[model samples]
Target: MKKKVVPYLLVSPYIIHFLIFIAFPVIFSIVLTFHKWNIISPMEYTGFANYIRLFQDTLFLKSIINTLIFLVIHIPLQIIVALFLAEVLNQKIFLRGFFRAAFFLPVVVSGVVVTILWQQLYGFDTGLLNKILVTLGFGKVGWLIDPKIAMPSIAIMATWKNVGLYIVLFLVGLQTVPKHYYEAADLEGATHWQKFFKITLPMINPTIFLVVILSTVGGFSLFIEPYILTGGGPLNSTLSAVLYIYKQAFFYYHMGYSATLGLFFALIILSVVIIQKKFIEREV
Candidate 1:
């Protein structure tokens, strides 16, 4: 009894913190979804009105569409780039550590700072990209301001920023692949692409699954980039689900509605992850 009690005591801090910060908020938010409340007003039961309004809200629907667009572009791009970089870095090379650090620097940096930096880079007229295009006699293009390209632009930036973390993940997976398998494949006269597909990819399926799930979750929770760079865009083209929730809660002071959105978004993420796991497990 003494030994068991001591272990529980040692873990008590984390348990308490989790209850207060994580569990309580989740429970409260679920409750909030059925009630109306502003910061200054007492909560009043509304019973699914917020959820009903969410379905009818055009902006909310647009935000969901934009988020899906970001996910569609961001996930594949992230996995491909991260896998390529990880494979390259796993090989014996000069300045490998430097390259790794350079790639991962953005992950450690502040998200707001990254958004601001990219905002300047994506500027229409005097931005670095357009400046280069103009120097080469090409016309300037709107990156953030154009509804047609705004969401994709955000997706590109997000991929650039987050790919480094996935690179590290893939590197760990790559190292776990047995060298003997590759050696055996080489003796069979397998091409590089063939070896990669037959050996490297299969061995790293778990890592690929993890990267997919995390990228999907991060893609759905997008806010800061759109909030900072496009402010949900020229025609709400870059609006994201999380940003819409923020707008509802703080900007519009619709706390109940925001909680409803949050709950719905949670369901969406949960469903996607479940489906993704089933599909990947079947494929693997």
Candidate 2:
């Protein structure tokens, strides 16, 4: 038997790259999760103590709850607004590309830059929102400063920053739906509500699913926006899982605990995805 030289040569680079970059790091991180390291001292194995400690860590628990709150706010808001915008734009409107590019512009900007920009917008004393609220006879509110509202404020910023990309995604999905489906429904004497429920809604399930998964992942990994804007809070209200992990790994120099958090967070993400898949399948 003769192996093909060209195929093997072509794949050899990829194999080497994966082993060096992906495989090795993944394996090393897993090993690192069980060992204590402060970079200067020798690494000492501590079994599952770091993971066990998570249950008793208030900051870690707060981070989890804060993340869930962000997701609860951001995901539904992103989906609804994106879908609504997509539907409006799909109606054979003028300047279609212009609108799409406008919507998707924020996604192209650096996340750090977006956070900075939104921080200014969400400023407690002189923010655009506060000015507008005051102009409209509403009380001047501390959007990013109040502990009760800090996470919600960050959620709003995050949603505004990323909703444009999801709009484009939903728009592309909407375009795939044949026009004749609408025509058939029209001939069948269907109302707008009926057509949307029976035709448009089901047709865009996959897009909705994709947005949900991405929004969920982004929600769980939130750090920069809260960190840059609130430094995880006027209290600890906006502290997130990744910010906590960063503090453990870098700020506090607890590499093993950080790795344990990473592993646990990964499991949480996996669980959410599995649940989403199951729910979607059952509905379908």
lDDT tens per residue, model 2, 1-284: 24668788889999999999989987888998889898889999998888779888998889989999999999998999999899899887899899989988888898899998888887767888888988999998788878889888888888888999999899889988999999999999999879888999899999999899888877888988887888887788998999989988889899888988888888988999899889978876
> Across residues 1-284, which tens digit of lDDT does each residue of candidate 1 receive?
89879989999999999999999999999999999999788999999898889889988888998999999999999999999999899999899999999999999999899899999999898789899999999988899988999898998999889989999999999999999999999999999899889999999999999999999988888998999998897799998999999999999899988999999888988999899999998987
The TM-score measured for candidate 1 stands at 0.91
Q: How many steric overlaps does candidate 1 have?
A: 0
TM-score of each: 0.91, 0.93
Cα RMSD, model 2? 1.9
Q: After superposition, how far is residue 196 of candidate 1 from its true place, in Å?
A: 2.3
Regions more than 4 Å wrong, model 2: 1-3, 188-190
Question: Which residue pairs clash within candidate 2?
Answer: none
- What local lDDT does model 2 show for residue 227? 78
